[model samples]
Target: MNPQIPDGLRELLALAAGAGQAPWRTLLRPGDWLLLLCCAALVAASYPLLWRGGVADRAIVKRDGRLVTELALNVARKYEVTGAIGTTVIEVQPGRARVLSDPGPRQYCVQQGWLSRANAVAICAPNHVTLQLAGRGGAHADYDTINY
Candidate 1:
Protein backbone atom coordinates (compact mmCIF):
# COMPACT_ATOMS: atom_id res chain seq x y z
CA MET A 1 0.00 0.00 0.00
CA ASN A 2 3.10 2.30 0.23
CA PRO A 3 3.23 4.44 -2.87
CA GLN A 4 6.30 6.48 -1.81
CA ILE A 5 9.79 5.29 -2.87
CA PRO A 6 12.01 3.98 -0.02
CA ASP A 7 14.37 6.62 1.56
CA GLY A 8 17.59 4.92 0.40
CA LEU A 9 16.25 4.36 -3.15
CA ARG A 10 15.07 7.99 -3.39
CA GLU A 11 18.46 9.26 -2.23
CA LEU A 12 20.21 6.95 -4.77
CA LEU A 13 17.94 8.26 -7.53
CA ALA A 14 18.68 11.90 -6.59
CA LEU A 15 22.42 11.28 -6.67
CA ALA A 16 22.17 9.40 -9.98
CA ALA A 17 20.28 12.32 -11.58
CA GLY A 18 23.02 14.85 -10.64
CA ALA A 19 26.04 12.45 -11.09
CA GLY A 20 25.99 12.49 -14.87
CA GLN A 21 24.72 16.11 -15.24
CA ALA A 22 27.00 19.08 -16.03
CA PRO A 23 26.91 22.46 -17.77
CA TRP A 24 27.00 22.17 -21.58
CA ARG A 25 30.35 23.97 -21.92
CA THR A 26 31.85 22.08 -18.95
CA LEU A 27 30.54 18.78 -20.31
CA LEU A 28 32.45 19.43 -23.57
CA ARG A 29 35.75 19.46 -21.55
CA PRO A 30 38.95 21.39 -22.29
CA GLY A 31 40.59 19.32 -25.10
CA ASP A 32 37.26 18.62 -26.80
CA TRP A 33 37.16 22.11 -28.36
CA LEU A 34 40.64 21.60 -29.80
CA LEU A 35 39.56 18.30 -31.31
CA LEU A 36 36.36 19.92 -32.59
CA LEU A 37 38.36 22.82 -34.05
CA CYS A 38 40.82 20.49 -35.72
CA CYS A 39 37.98 18.48 -37.21
CA ALA A 40 36.27 21.69 -38.44
CA ALA A 41 39.52 22.94 -39.94
CA LEU A 42 40.07 19.63 -41.71
CA VAL A 43 36.61 19.78 -43.26
CA ALA A 44 37.13 23.40 -44.33
CA ALA A 45 40.55 22.68 -45.83
CA SER A 46 39.21 19.71 -47.79
CA TYR A 47 36.78 21.89 -49.72
CA PRO A 48 39.41 23.23 -52.12
CA LEU A 49 41.04 19.81 -52.43
CA LEU A 50 37.79 18.54 -53.92
CA TRP A 51 37.82 18.70 -57.73
CA ARG A 52 35.19 20.80 -59.45
CA GLY A 53 34.73 20.48 -63.25
CA GLY A 54 32.32 23.31 -64.01
CA VAL A 55 34.82 25.41 -66.04
CA ALA A 56 37.53 22.80 -66.22
CA ASP A 57 35.84 21.36 -69.25
CA ARG A 58 38.62 20.83 -71.78
CA ALA A 59 41.24 18.12 -72.27
CA ILE A 60 44.31 19.46 -74.01
CA VAL A 61 46.88 17.13 -75.52
CA LYS A 62 50.40 18.33 -76.22
CA ARG A 63 52.88 16.66 -78.56
CA ASP A 64 56.56 17.48 -78.54
CA GLY A 65 56.07 20.40 -76.17
CA ARG A 66 53.43 21.89 -78.48
CA LEU A 67 49.71 21.88 -77.99
CA VAL A 68 48.46 19.32 -80.51
CA THR A 69 44.79 19.25 -79.64
CA GLU A 70 42.16 20.57 -77.25
CA LEU A 71 38.97 18.58 -76.84
CA ALA A 72 35.80 19.43 -74.97
CA LEU A 73 35.46 17.14 -71.98
CA ASN A 74 31.67 16.87 -72.30
CA VAL A 75 32.09 15.10 -75.66
CA ALA A 76 33.10 11.50 -75.23
CA ARG A 77 35.68 10.51 -77.84
CA LYS A 78 39.06 8.96 -78.49
CA TYR A 79 41.83 11.09 -79.96
CA GLU A 80 45.13 9.98 -81.45
CA VAL A 81 48.11 12.28 -81.32
CA THR A 82 51.24 11.53 -83.31
CA GLY A 83 54.42 12.89 -81.82
CA ALA A 84 58.14 12.52 -82.46
CA ILE A 85 58.17 9.18 -80.69
CA GLY A 86 54.85 7.71 -81.91
CA THR A 87 51.09 7.89 -81.67
CA THR A 88 49.28 8.29 -78.36
CA VAL A 89 45.69 7.29 -77.85
CA ILE A 90 43.75 9.65 -75.50
CA GLU A 91 40.29 8.80 -74.32
CA VAL A 92 38.05 11.68 -73.21
CA GLN A 93 34.89 11.52 -71.14
CA PRO A 94 32.70 14.07 -69.43
CA GLY A 95 34.91 15.96 -67.01
CA ARG A 96 37.74 13.44 -67.37
CA ALA A 97 40.60 12.39 -69.66
CA ARG A 98 43.09 9.52 -69.84
CA VAL A 99 45.61 7.83 -72.10
CA LEU A 100 44.40 4.48 -73.37
CA SER A 101 47.73 3.75 -75.00
CA ASP A 102 50.96 5.50 -75.92
CA PRO A 103 54.13 4.67 -77.83
CA GLY A 104 56.32 5.19 -74.80
CA PRO A 105 58.93 2.83 -73.41
CA ARG A 106 57.54 2.59 -69.88
CA GLN A 107 53.97 3.60 -70.69
CA TYR A 108 54.09 5.99 -67.78
CA CYS A 109 51.24 8.14 -69.02
CA VAL A 110 48.90 5.20 -69.05
CA GLN A 111 50.01 4.37 -65.55
CA GLN A 112 49.47 7.97 -64.42
CA GLY A 113 45.80 7.18 -64.85
CA TRP A 114 42.78 9.51 -65.40
CA LEU A 115 42.69 13.31 -65.29
CA SER A 116 39.37 14.74 -64.16
CA ARG A 117 40.45 17.67 -62.00
CA ALA A 118 41.35 21.10 -63.25
CA ASN A 119 45.08 21.57 -64.00
CA ALA A 120 45.80 17.83 -63.75
CA VAL A 121 48.33 16.48 -66.28
CA ALA A 122 49.47 13.12 -67.65
CA ILE A 123 52.86 13.14 -69.31
CA CYS A 124 54.46 10.44 -71.45
CA ALA A 125 58.07 11.45 -71.46
CA PRO A 126 59.22 8.85 -73.95
CA ASN A 127 56.36 9.55 -76.36
CA HIS A 128 56.72 13.36 -75.97
CA VAL A 129 53.02 13.62 -75.18
CA THR A 130 51.27 15.53 -72.42
CA LEU A 131 47.60 15.84 -71.63
CA GLN A 132 46.28 18.54 -69.26
CA LEU A 133 42.87 19.41 -67.93
CA ALA A 134 41.73 23.01 -68.52
CA GLY A 135 38.97 25.22 -67.28
CA ARG A 136 37.09 28.05 -69.03
CA GLY A 137 37.23 30.26 -65.94
CA GLY A 138 39.37 33.29 -65.21
CA ALA A 139 42.23 31.36 -63.62
CA HIS A 140 42.43 28.80 -66.45
CA ALA A 141 41.47 31.31 -69.21
CA ASP A 142 41.44 29.15 -72.35
CA TYR A 143 44.94 27.63 -72.43
CA ASP A 144 46.67 30.62 -70.72
CA THR A 145 49.95 29.75 -72.34
CA ILE A 146 50.08 26.14 -71.10
CA ASN A 147 53.47 25.67 -72.84
CA TYR A 148 52.94 21.95 -73.19
Candidate 2:
Protein backbone atom coordinates (compact mmCIF):
# COMPACT_ATOMS: atom_id res chain seq x y z
CA MET A 1 0.00 0.00 0.00
CA ASN A 2 1.17 3.64 -0.76
CA PRO A 3 0.92 6.40 1.81
CA GLN A 4 -1.50 9.22 0.95
CA ILE A 5 -0.23 12.87 0.97
CA PRO A 6 -2.42 15.95 1.59
CA ASP A 7 -3.48 17.62 -1.69
CA GLY A 8 -2.84 21.16 -0.38
CA LEU A 9 0.74 20.25 0.76
CA ARG A 10 1.47 18.49 -2.51
CA GLU A 11 0.32 21.52 -4.51
CA LEU A 12 2.34 23.88 -2.36
CA LEU A 13 5.52 21.78 -2.74
CA ALA A 14 5.03 21.65 -6.47
CA LEU A 15 4.53 25.43 -6.66
CA ALA A 16 7.68 26.03 -4.59
CA ALA A 17 9.77 23.69 -6.73
CA GLY A 18 8.61 25.48 -9.89
CA ALA A 19 9.17 29.04 -8.62
CA GLY A 20 12.54 30.79 -8.88
CA GLN A 21 13.91 33.35 -6.41
CA ALA A 22 12.11 36.66 -6.18
CA PRO A 23 13.81 39.91 -7.25
CA TRP A 24 15.71 41.94 -4.62
CA ARG A 25 13.50 44.99 -5.15
CA THR A 26 10.45 42.85 -4.43
CA LEU A 27 11.96 41.72 -1.09
CA LEU A 28 13.25 45.14 0.05
CA ARG A 29 11.09 47.05 2.51
CA PRO A 30 10.77 50.86 2.81
CA GLY A 31 12.63 50.80 6.16
CA ASP A 32 15.68 49.16 4.52
CA TRP A 33 16.44 52.51 2.87
CA LEU A 34 17.32 53.86 6.30
CA LEU A 35 19.78 51.05 6.84
CA LEU A 36 21.31 51.67 3.42
CA LEU A 37 21.68 55.35 4.20
CA CYS A 38 23.34 54.57 7.53
CA CYS A 39 25.83 52.29 5.81
CA ALA A 40 26.58 55.03 3.30
CA ALA A 41 27.14 57.51 6.09
CA LEU A 42 29.55 55.19 7.86
CA VAL A 43 31.53 54.73 4.67
CA ALA A 44 31.63 58.47 4.08
CA ALA A 45 32.76 59.14 7.67
CA SER A 46 35.89 56.96 7.25
CA TYR A 47 37.21 59.06 4.37
CA PRO A 48 38.88 61.70 6.57
CA LEU A 49 41.10 59.22 8.39
CA LEU A 50 43.19 58.73 5.28
CA TRP A 51 44.13 62.42 5.14
CA ARG A 52 44.54 62.72 8.94
CA GLY A 53 47.25 60.07 9.22
CA GLY A 54 50.31 62.25 8.43
CA VAL A 55 49.73 65.24 10.73
CA ALA A 56 52.06 64.19 13.54
CA ASP A 57 54.66 66.78 14.65
CA ARG A 58 56.80 65.15 17.32
CA ALA A 59 59.34 62.36 17.65
CA ILE A 60 59.83 60.42 20.85
CA VAL A 61 62.62 57.97 21.50
CA LYS A 62 62.49 55.57 24.40
CA ARG A 63 65.13 53.22 25.72
CA ASP A 64 64.75 50.55 28.42
CA GLY A 65 61.30 51.76 29.41
CA ARG A 66 62.58 55.30 30.03
CA LEU A 67 62.07 58.43 28.03
CA VAL A 68 65.42 58.96 26.30
CA THR A 69 64.67 62.07 24.25
CA GLU A 70 61.79 64.03 22.83
CA LEU A 71 62.28 66.17 19.72
CA ALA A 72 59.99 68.62 18.06
CA LEU A 73 59.38 68.20 14.36
CA ASN A 74 59.30 70.94 11.62
CA VAL A 75 63.10 71.16 11.69
CA ALA A 76 65.48 68.81 9.92
CA ARG A 77 67.99 67.13 12.22
CA LYS A 78 69.48 63.84 13.37
CA TYR A 79 69.66 62.52 16.90
CA GLU A 80 71.55 59.62 18.47
CA VAL A 81 70.33 57.56 21.42
CA THR A 82 72.03 54.87 23.44
CA GLY A 83 70.02 51.85 24.48
CA ALA A 84 70.70 49.09 27.00
CA ILE A 85 72.54 46.98 24.41
CA GLY A 86 73.83 49.32 21.71
CA THR A 87 73.24 52.59 19.85
CA THR A 88 70.44 53.86 17.60
CA VAL A 89 70.24 56.74 15.11
CA ILE A 90 67.10 58.78 14.39
CA GLU A 91 66.43 61.49 11.85
CA VAL A 92 63.50 63.89 11.69
CA GLN A 93 62.12 66.12 8.98
CA PRO A 94 59.25 68.61 8.86
CA GLY A 95 56.51 66.03 9.33
CA ARG A 96 58.27 62.68 9.59
CA ALA A 97 60.90 60.65 11.42
CA ARG A 98 62.70 57.39 10.72
CA VAL A 99 65.38 55.09 12.06
CA LEU A 100 68.71 55.44 10.29
CA SER A 101 70.43 52.65 12.17
CA ASP A 102 69.79 50.22 15.01
CA PRO A 103 72.50 47.87 16.25
CA GLY A 104 70.90 44.45 15.91
CA PRO A 105 71.43 41.13 14.25
CA ARG A 106 68.28 41.26 12.17
CA GLN A 107 68.35 45.01 11.43
CA TYR A 108 64.55 44.94 11.51
CA CYS A 109 64.27 48.42 12.98
CA VAL A 110 66.57 49.87 10.35
CA GLN A 111 64.51 48.28 7.58
CA GLN A 112 61.19 49.82 8.64
CA GLY A 113 61.55 52.54 5.98
CA TRP A 114 60.12 56.06 6.32
CA LEU A 115 57.60 56.98 8.99
CA SER A 116 56.02 60.19 7.79
CA ARG A 117 52.64 59.92 9.43
CA ALA A 118 51.08 59.94 12.86
CA ASN A 119 51.55 56.87 15.06
CA ALA A 120 54.40 55.39 13.05
CA VAL A 121 56.84 53.30 15.07
CA ALA A 122 60.00 51.19 14.81
CA ILE A 123 61.52 48.99 17.48
CA CYS A 124 64.75 47.02 17.79
CA ALA A 125 64.37 44.39 20.43
CA PRO A 126 67.98 43.26 20.24
CA ASN A 127 69.22 46.77 20.99
CA HIS A 128 66.28 47.91 23.15
CA VAL A 129 65.58 50.98 21.04
CA THR A 130 62.24 52.42 19.98
CA LEU A 131 61.11 55.28 17.74
CA GLN A 132 57.61 56.69 17.90
CA LEU A 133 55.71 59.64 16.49
CA ALA A 134 53.04 61.84 18.04
CA GLY A 135 50.80 64.80 17.38
CA ARG A 136 49.91 67.74 19.61
CA GLY A 137 46.67 66.00 20.48
CA GLY A 138 48.36 62.83 21.75
CA ALA A 139 50.94 60.15 21.13
CA HIS A 140 49.95 57.19 19.00
CA ALA A 141 51.62 53.83 19.34
CA ASP A 142 50.76 50.89 17.13
CA TYR A 143 52.67 48.55 19.41
CA ASP A 144 52.85 49.75 23.00
CA THR A 145 55.98 47.93 24.09
CA ILE A 146 58.17 44.98 23.20
CA ASN A 147 60.58 43.09 25.48
CA TYR A 148 63.07 40.54 24.37
Candidate 3:
Protein backbone atom coordinates (compact mmCIF):
# COMPACT_ATOMS: atom_id res chain seq x y z
CA MET A 1 0.00 0.00 0.00
CA ASN A 2 1.24 3.54 -0.83
CA PRO A 3 1.22 6.40 1.71
CA GLN A 4 -1.07 9.29 0.96
CA ILE A 5 -0.27 12.99 1.49
CA PRO A 6 -2.77 15.67 2.40
CA ASP A 7 -3.54 18.32 -0.25
CA GLY A 8 -2.90 21.10 2.24
CA LEU A 9 0.58 19.74 2.99
CA ARG A 10 1.40 19.56 -0.72
CA GLU A 11 0.30 23.15 -1.25
CA LEU A 12 2.45 24.29 1.71
CA LEU A 13 5.52 22.53 0.35
CA ALA A 14 4.99 24.12 -3.08
CA LEU A 15 4.70 27.54 -1.46
CA ALA A 16 7.91 27.02 0.50
CA ALA A 17 9.77 25.94 -2.65
CA GLY A 18 8.61 29.08 -4.46
CA ALA A 19 9.69 31.27 -1.50
CA GLY A 20 13.38 30.36 -1.94
CA GLN A 21 13.85 33.12 -4.54
CA ALA A 22 16.39 35.94 -4.16
CA PRO A 23 15.49 39.01 -2.12
CA TRP A 24 14.32 42.15 -3.91
CA ARG A 25 15.70 45.67 -3.49
CA THR A 26 13.41 48.50 -2.37
CA LEU A 27 13.56 52.14 -3.51
CA LEU A 28 12.34 54.81 -1.12
CA ARG A 29 9.99 57.27 -2.76
CA PRO A 30 10.21 61.06 -2.28
CA GLY A 31 7.25 60.97 0.09
CA ASP A 32 8.94 58.25 2.13
CA TRP A 33 12.12 60.33 2.41
CA LEU A 34 10.11 63.34 3.56
CA LEU A 35 8.44 61.24 6.25
CA LEU A 36 11.77 59.92 7.42
CA LEU A 37 13.21 63.43 7.64
CA CYS A 38 10.22 64.59 9.67
CA CYS A 39 10.59 61.71 12.11
CA ALA A 40 14.30 62.43 12.52
CA ALA A 41 13.60 66.10 13.22
CA LEU A 42 11.03 65.26 15.88
CA VAL A 43 13.41 62.84 17.58
CA ALA A 44 16.21 65.39 17.54
CA ALA A 45 13.97 68.01 19.13
CA SER A 46 13.00 65.68 22.02
CA TYR A 47 16.48 64.28 22.67
CA PRO A 48 17.24 66.48 25.67
CA LEU A 49 14.08 65.54 27.53
CA LEU A 50 14.42 61.90 26.58
CA TRP A 51 18.05 61.52 27.66
CA ARG A 52 18.38 63.87 30.67
CA GLY A 53 18.52 61.95 33.94
CA GLY A 54 16.01 62.50 36.77
CA VAL A 55 14.79 65.70 35.12
CA ALA A 56 12.01 64.00 33.18
CA ASP A 57 10.87 61.57 35.90
CA ARG A 58 9.81 61.67 39.56
CA ALA A 59 10.99 59.46 42.42
CA ILE A 60 8.82 58.47 45.40
CA VAL A 61 10.48 57.21 48.54
CA LYS A 62 8.78 55.47 51.43
CA ARG A 63 10.33 54.45 54.74
CA ASP A 64 8.92 52.82 57.88
CA GLY A 65 5.48 52.70 56.24
CA ARG A 66 5.42 56.49 55.66
CA LEU A 67 5.94 58.67 52.61
CA VAL A 68 9.34 60.27 53.17
CA THR A 69 9.98 62.31 50.05
CA GLU A 70 9.73 62.65 46.30
CA LEU A 71 12.43 64.03 44.03
CA ALA A 72 13.38 64.21 40.43
CA LEU A 73 16.10 61.86 39.14
CA ASN A 74 19.11 63.82 37.89
CA VAL A 75 21.46 60.91 37.28
CA ALA A 76 21.65 57.14 37.24
CA ARG A 77 23.68 55.60 40.05
CA LYS A 78 23.52 53.61 43.23
CA TYR A 79 21.23 55.46 45.72
CA GLU A 80 22.13 54.93 49.36
CA VAL A 81 19.30 55.24 51.90
CA THR A 82 20.23 56.03 55.49
CA GLY A 83 18.72 57.55 58.69
CA ALA A 84 16.81 54.47 59.85
CA ILE A 85 18.18 53.58 63.26
CA GLY A 86 19.59 50.02 63.50
CA THR A 87 19.15 49.65 59.76
CA THR A 88 21.77 49.50 57.03
CA VAL A 89 22.13 51.62 53.92
CA ILE A 90 19.62 50.93 51.16
CA GLU A 91 21.23 50.84 47.75
CA VAL A 92 19.13 51.54 44.64
CA GLN A 93 20.14 50.80 41.08
CA PRO A 94 18.41 50.54 37.74
CA GLY A 95 15.44 48.14 38.15
CA ARG A 96 16.46 47.09 41.68
CA ALA A 97 17.29 48.23 45.26
CA ARG A 98 18.79 46.29 48.13
CA VAL A 99 19.16 47.02 51.83
CA LEU A 100 22.46 46.07 53.41
CA SER A 101 20.93 45.94 56.89
CA ASP A 102 19.91 42.66 58.39
CA PRO A 103 16.84 44.13 60.06
CA GLY A 104 14.94 40.87 59.92
CA PRO A 105 14.99 37.34 58.62
CA ARG A 106 13.31 37.90 55.26
CA GLN A 107 15.84 40.36 53.77
CA TYR A 108 13.36 40.80 50.94
CA CYS A 109 14.01 44.52 50.33
CA VAL A 110 17.68 43.85 49.94
CA GLN A 111 16.68 41.30 47.34
CA GLN A 112 14.92 43.92 45.20
CA GLY A 113 17.32 46.17 43.22
CA TRP A 114 16.94 49.46 41.34
CA LEU A 115 13.99 50.33 39.12
CA SER A 116 14.50 52.49 36.00
CA ARG A 117 11.21 53.03 34.19
CA ALA A 118 8.67 55.66 35.20
CA ASN A 119 6.07 54.48 37.76
CA ALA A 120 7.85 51.16 38.39
CA VAL A 121 8.37 50.20 42.05
CA ALA A 122 10.40 48.13 44.49
CA ILE A 123 9.22 47.18 47.96
CA CYS A 124 10.73 45.80 51.12
CA ALA A 125 7.96 43.41 52.00
CA PRO A 126 9.51 42.67 55.38
CA ASN A 127 9.91 46.34 56.46
CA HIS A 128 6.68 47.56 54.85
CA VAL A 129 8.66 49.96 52.65
CA THR A 130 8.29 50.94 49.01
CA LEU A 131 10.06 53.02 46.35
CA GLN A 132 8.13 54.07 43.30
CA LEU A 133 8.55 56.31 40.26
CA ALA A 134 5.92 58.75 39.00
CA GLY A 135 4.31 58.49 35.63
CA ARG A 136 3.69 61.35 33.22
CA GLY A 137 1.57 64.15 34.68
CA GLY A 138 1.67 62.48 38.10
CA ALA A 139 4.89 64.27 39.09
CA HIS A 140 4.94 67.83 40.41
CA ALA A 141 5.48 70.32 37.57
CA ASP A 142 7.05 73.16 39.49
CA TYR A 143 9.17 75.39 37.24
CA ASP A 144 11.95 75.59 39.82
CA THR A 145 12.58 71.89 39.51
CA ILE A 146 13.23 72.13 35.79
CA ASN A 147 16.93 72.22 34.91
CA TYR A 148 17.79 74.70 32.22
Best by lDDT: 1
Clashing pairs in 2: none
How should the candidates be ordered by TM-score, best one leading? Answer: 2, 1, 3
Flag regions of model 3 displaced more than 4 Å: 1-56, 76-85, 92-102, 139-148
Give stretches of model 2 more than 4 Å off.
1-50, 140-148
Error of 3 at 87 (Å): 2.5
Instruction: Indicate the TM-score of model 2.
Output: 0.59
In order, candidate lDDTs are 0.80, 0.78, 0.56
TM-score per model over all chains: 0.57, 0.59, 0.40
Q: Pick the winner on lDDT between candidates 2 and 3.
A: 2
Q: How would you encode candidate 3's per-residue C-alpha lDDT over 57-118 as one tens digit per residue?
A: 65676877677765556544444444343343544444333344535467665555544555
- Scanning candidate 3 in windows of ten residues, the lowest lDDT window is 139-148
Candidate 2 per-residue C-alpha lDDT over 71-114 given as tens digits, one digit per residue, 9 for 90 to 100: 88889999998876777889888887888987788988888877
Which residue pairs in candidate 1 collide?
none
Q: For candidate 1, which ten residues in a row score worst on lDDT?
A: 139-148
Runs in model 1 deviating more than 4 A are 1-55, 138-148
